[model samples]
Structure formats: structure tokens, C-alpha cells
Target: MSATYGVPNLEHCIIIAVIHNDGTMHSIGVINLEEFDNAAAVEIFAGRSLDSEEFAIRVVAVADADHAAQGVFALDAITGAAERAGISLLNVIMTPKIAAGQHWTDLRTQEYGILPDPAMTAPAIAAIVDGFGPLPDAEEITRLFTEITPADTDHARTTQRDNPRFGRDTLHEVRKTIVEYLRTYDPDWADGGVIGADFAADERTRLLDNTAEGLAARIGVLVEVSGSARDALLGLAVIDIPTAARIYTHIANQLEGIHRAHMLAVAAVLYHVDGRPFHARDALYRCGLAVLGESGHLSETMPVIGRALLAAARANVETDTARRFLALGPIAARRFGIETPDYDLYPAE
Candidate 1:
């Protein structure tokens, strides 16, 4: 019998583990039961996945669970899944205190509670051994979206000075500056991120990854450039500038009384191009929109009409409502050629 062990959470995600012949537990991925029921979960373990030797999964973990409702215990859920999969559960466990303290129980004996080794009993250590970072707590995860770092504040000021507002007549000026820099930079300068913090900056250079394919996909290129140009118009607030001028621009962005540093201009354009509406809108809240060129306002989602609505919603940007759809952005719209169609940035309601 293949032995499988896992952790179950009544309140959150349920994890499962793999027990090798040596009796050491190697943690497998967490099977989030928040969206699926026991029967569905059993199907996952039975033959096609995890144990099936599949490839990468880039899906975002989502949930619509009701905490008030009754739910199955993790221990029961995983065992039920194992049985349905025609496998045996050597010893499945679901408990708390992932961070500190020790809790373990004897799998065979009814009389003794086993205090297993700290490194062994903790699922995190096993996962780490298998090359995964320990899962972050909810507060830590939430902090990624909300915290505006000093680098963020400084990026806005510096970006603004280097790239100022421009009407359509003057938009051509960016070709000499931003465009040129994008084209001639050393490939190493645009290298993929070797570390975590470089993700967004690394993302900035992705449009150039497949030049041969990109050349064939000319229209795709236009879409990319247009979107970036629009986002650049909105995101140019990043360049550093004097405070008095910065404050004036902040007011125009319709941030009410919000300060300039909060604009998160670099992040705003990144979000806009990447199609993270919640993040983009949040950047707007901090004043990303203040960077938009006056002439750029002609388009729809350039957010010409929604300015008031967005301003009104500024206070609620911190809510989950603003961050609910953190997903991929659309492609086919990132290029520059005279051949293009005129349409709404905000399509009709």
C-alpha cells in the first residue's frame, strides 16, 4: 500500500504528504478544498495529478467558502480521498502551530501521544527540504499588496522628472528617450530576474523576448506599444520631482488629499500593462493618474470618464473589492505602427 499523509484545516487549505519507504514524510502540495468537495478532491488523488506526475500550475488560489457552514475535518477528507484513489493512508494528520511548539501522535498505538522531532513533525521543514518556502501567514501575504515602500515613493519622484507629461503633439518626444533606451540596451541590462524582488523590472523587458515572433505579429506589437504609451501617460508620475510641483500634480490626479509618494507610478504602469485592475486602480488612488498627458484623456479607459468614480472609490481601494481580480493582462495590444484602430479604452456599458 502506498502511504499518504496530509494536514487538514477546518478553516483553510488542506495539505497532503507522501510517506516514503523509510517512513520519512515528504510534503506534497496542498489540495485546496475550499472550492471543491470531498468527492471532487478524491478524484484528484486517484490517478491524474500530484501522484500523476504533471507539469506546472500557474493558477491563483481562490475561494468562496462560507466559514459559518459546517465542513469536513481534514483527517477524514484526506483519508477518504486516499481510499477513493485505491491507496492507503499510512497516517494522515491535520493540526495547528506550524510556526512553533511541537505536536505529534503515535500512528499505531492508542495509548501514547508521540512527540516527534521538530524537524520531522513540522510539514514546513519537509516542504523546505523538497525545495519550497514555508507558506506565509495571511497578514504577511496581504502586506504585499498594501505596503508602499520607500523605493516606491522614490521611484515616483525620479520617474516624473525624467519623463514629464506630453500631449499628442509632444508624445513623439518619448521615442527619443524611452523608446531608444528600450531598443539599444545591452541584453544583460534586460536580463530575466535572477531573484524575487526583480520581478516587475524583469516583466518590463518581456515584450522584447521573442523578437522574431514579435516581428511576425505586428498587430500584437501595436497593441503592446499603445497600452504602454497609455500606461506611461498614466504612470509617468514615478520620475522624481520637486515637492511643490509634485503636490500640484497629485491634486490633478484626483486623489483628494492623498500624498504624492503613494502614487506608486512604476507599479501603476506595470499593473496597467500587466492587467491587474485592482493594483492599477490602487495606484490611481495614490495618484498615478496625475501623470496622464492632457491629450491622452481622449481615450475611454485612459479613465477619462471614470475619474470621479475612481476618486470616490479611493477610500475603498484597501478593501478586497479592489483587489479581487489579480490575474493576467491581455496581450495583442503592445506595439507601435500607424496601422491601428480607434476604439474605447472603456467600452460602452
Candidate 2:
């Protein structure tokens, strides 16, 4: 029988443990289910072969079955993967407090035993089984945490279905705000031609003409508007910024490449204003890459972009965000290139 560990939400990975009839258990693989669905599990399973072994499988969850619905892998997909992997899927079990030596029996008829001694508890157990190193020192561990943590504010709790004004509407409102701000404050930036109107109409038309490959262009137009508005919104403290951030995050999640980056930048700025520096840093890292892509300076291996990304990382006050962003520097360098010497003061380590 084989066993799998599934986290329903933002964890983004499933731990697959292969168990032999002889009772030997080994956590064989960690699967990253990007979209968090049953189909994703099936895809992961289809990629592997179990040598035609008769395998019964069980899935263990850290929370109850209800928690699984939030964003966890679908139960059907787990069973499907087991079948494809040449194993029988027995059941799915949940453990509310993974390390408490307890589990939710109601989730499945079959009960599975905990891992024997020397294995860490549930939350840490998976990582230990995956062969990770010892835990970091308290100081280092503390340093890894972000300074401005999520506070579960009213805006943070806003749901998509609740208000239903997240996507294009939010962007339109932000554009209007930007136009009013520019007209009232910075007339020079608008060139006196059109101040708050849809400046991206031409770009949008060009992009729509080639819909197959215009996602980045679509994102670029939004990004340009958002970028222009960012400086203006910096001093304004209002709920609109949070709303825009939420919308940008939603947009970024739907896109790739430059569009994703630009949307993330808009989100980052909003997050920064909302005092969520950690989220801002993540958005900025992607934004840096997207900015390069937008500038038409991306290359197969551009160290210049890497240096600029590194600079953004170094300038960030949040240490953990900086570390994470810097980690992507080599990756960006290898995929894109652009020289923005203005950021040179903050060299990436």
C-alpha cells in the first residue's frame, strides 16, 4: 500500500509515500500540484510507473476533510493517481493536530498508524522524511520571518464573490483615480493630451489583433498605467489602494511573463502601502523581471537584469523578502538581460 500527504491550501506540494506489503515505508516523492486539483495529481501519477505492483494507497491530511476543499488536491485525483501508479487507493484520513498523535477517523473508514519513532511530527515530519537538514538556530529562524505580518484586516478578508468588483472594474477605478491625481497634481506627466482616459487604447488594439500572443502586451498596458499611478498613490492613504492590490494579485495569478510581473508590481505597491512588506518584496521580484520583459531588453542570459533584480532585493528593508528575491537573480540573469545602472548601488550578493 502507498500513502500520500496532502496539504489543501497554499502549501503547493503533496508527499507521496510508497509502502510495501512487508511494511517498509519510504516517502518517494514530493509533488508540486500547481493548480491544486485532482487532475494535477493525476498528471503527477501519469508521469510515474510503479512496475505493475499491486498497491493500496491512503492519503493523510493535516486538517479535517473540510479543510481539503479550500484548495487541496481533489480526492478523486488522489485515487486516480494511485490507480495509474499501479496501486489501489484505500482511503483518505485527516489529523487535526498532526503531531498530537491524533487523526480524524470520520474522514475515512481505514485508520493508518503514525510513523515510528525517530521521525519528526506531522508539520515537521514531512520535511524530515524528505531529507532536509536540521532546524536553523532560533536567531536565524526568527530572521527568516517577515517584519510586517498579515493582520487579517477587513480588506484582507474580502472575498471574490462578496463584492464582485475585482478585475476590470477595479482597474478602471484605479485608472480614474490616477487620472484625477495627475490632472490635479502633475500635469506635466500627462503631456496635456489625455489625462485619466484609456491611454492604452492603441496598445490594446494592437495586442487584440494578435490575441494568441498578446497576454504580455495586455499586462504591459495595465502595468504602465499602474506604474504611473504608483508614485501618485504613494502619499494617498485610502481603501482604494488595497482594493487595487487585491485585483492586481488576482490578475497576476491569471497571467504569466510580463503581465504577471507588472500586475505583481501594482500589487506590491499596494501591499507596501498597506504595510505588508513581505508580499511587496515577492511582487517586486517578479515585477523586476516583467519590467525587463516590457523594456524589450530580455535575453536568454542577461546578467544585467540579474544585477538589477539583486539591487531591488538589497534595497528592500525586509530581509527575508530580500533573500528570496536575490535567490531568483541567477534565474532572471539566465533568462533575460537589461542594464539599469541606476540600481547599481544595491548589488546582489
Supply candidate 2's per-residue lDDT for 339: 15
Q: What value does the lDDT take at residue 332 in candidate 2? A: 30
Q: What Cα-based lDDT does every candidate model obtain?
A: 0.34, 0.43
List, residue by residue over 1-349, the lDDT tens digit for candidate 2: 1122222231334445565645555345445444457666777567665543534455544444445553244555676667666775555654443433443442446555643222344534665444332243335323322222212223412432354433244334444443343343333445664544465444333332332232223433433334323222222213244543543454455554554554565455455445555456556666566557656565532233233444555764443432343333233322222111121224555
What does candidate 1's lDDT look like per residue over 1-349, in tens digits? Answer: 0111122222345445454445554445655545657675566566543332322111111112452121234445555665655554554433332322324332323222333433344564655454332333335324433432211223333433455432222233322223433433335443443334355445433432222221212211222234454333322222211221222222223221122222243234334333244444555654434334323342333332135335435664422221121111111112322112222233436
**Per-residue lDDT of 343 in model 1:** 24
Query: Each model's TM-score, in the order given?
Result: 0.29, 0.30
- Looking at candidate 2, the ten consecutive residues that score lowest on lDDT are 336-345
Clashes of 1: 24
lDDT of 1 at 209: 29
Show pairs that collide, candidate 2: 8-72, 55-88, 299-337
Candidate 2, 6: how far from true, in Å? 15
Q: Which regions of candidate 1 are displaced past 4 Å? A: 1-11, 19-27, 31-36, 49-74, 106-349
